[model samples]
Target: MNEADVFTMLRDTILAVLIASGPVLALALIVGLVIAFFQALTQIQEMTLTFVPKIVAIFLGIVASLPFIYATLTGLSDRVFDLIGRGGP
Candidate 1:
């Protein structure tokens, strides 16, 4: 691939990654903020309290989001493969 083609491919890959990960990442951020707020208010300050909820929230987010993520990744892969099949330079 030429420089421009390479750049476009890289950009597309990064966009796919961000789109696929966005939900879980946003959930993790929100969970962390909530946990921080709770710790500040109740002074629980438990390590597991901080970690467990974030982990669970992220897992749930991932589970809920799997279909969309899979579809997005599959679409990207299909496009990449199509380009290759078309004799991409």
Candidate 2:
């Protein structure tokens, strides 16, 4: 593959990775923010308080988003395989 083709492939792979990771990352951010707010209001300075709830919330978020995540990954895999099959470059 030429440099241009390699660059394009890398770009596409990065985009796919970002899109796949977006939901989990967003969930983590939202959960963290909410936990922070709760800790601030209640003055609960327990580290476990923040960590446990965030972990649970992130786990639940992952469970709920599993289907979408699976689909996205599978789609990306298929696309990559197709490109390879077609002798991309």
Candidate 3:
């Protein structure tokens, strides 16, 4: 209802999103970096090499982290819903 409350809500939402995405993004980033490094050392430049592993890693990461992601998002939703139920001053 107020500027502070609005900003706080926005911050919480953004943080929740970032935290929820962290696992997948981090896995992809690490896999990509490792593949790039290997390619650099071996001089084997294959586009599929980068795409395939990252895809698999991301998929696995998402499956493995689903619960953590759900909890993070659910917590944010609960807070938001509770805020709405409280009514603004």
Kindly list the per-residue Cα lDDT of model 3 for residues 1-89, writing each as its tens digit.
Answer: 99999999999999999999998999999999999999999999999999999999999999999999999999999999999999952
Stretches > 4 Å off in candidate 2? none
For candidate 2, give the lDDT: 0.84
Cα RMSDs, all models:
1.0, 1.3, 1.0
- Pairs clashing within candidate 2: none
RMSD of 3: 1.0
Candidate 1: residue pairs that collide: 1-89
Candidate 1 per-residue lDDT over residues 1-89, each given as its tens digit = 68898899889999999999998999999999989998999988789898888888988999999999999999999989988998785
Assess every candidate by TM-score.
0.95, 0.87, 0.96
Model 2 TM-score (2 dp): 0.87
* Backbone atom clashes (below 3 Å) for every candidate: 1, 0, 0
Which candidate should be chosen as best, given lDDT against the real structure? 3
Whole-model lDDT per candidate: 0.92, 0.84, 0.95
RMSD of 2: 1.3
**Top of the candidates by TM-score:** 3
Give RMSD (Å) of candidate 1 vs. truth.
1.0
| Rank order (by lDDT, best first) | 3, 1, 2
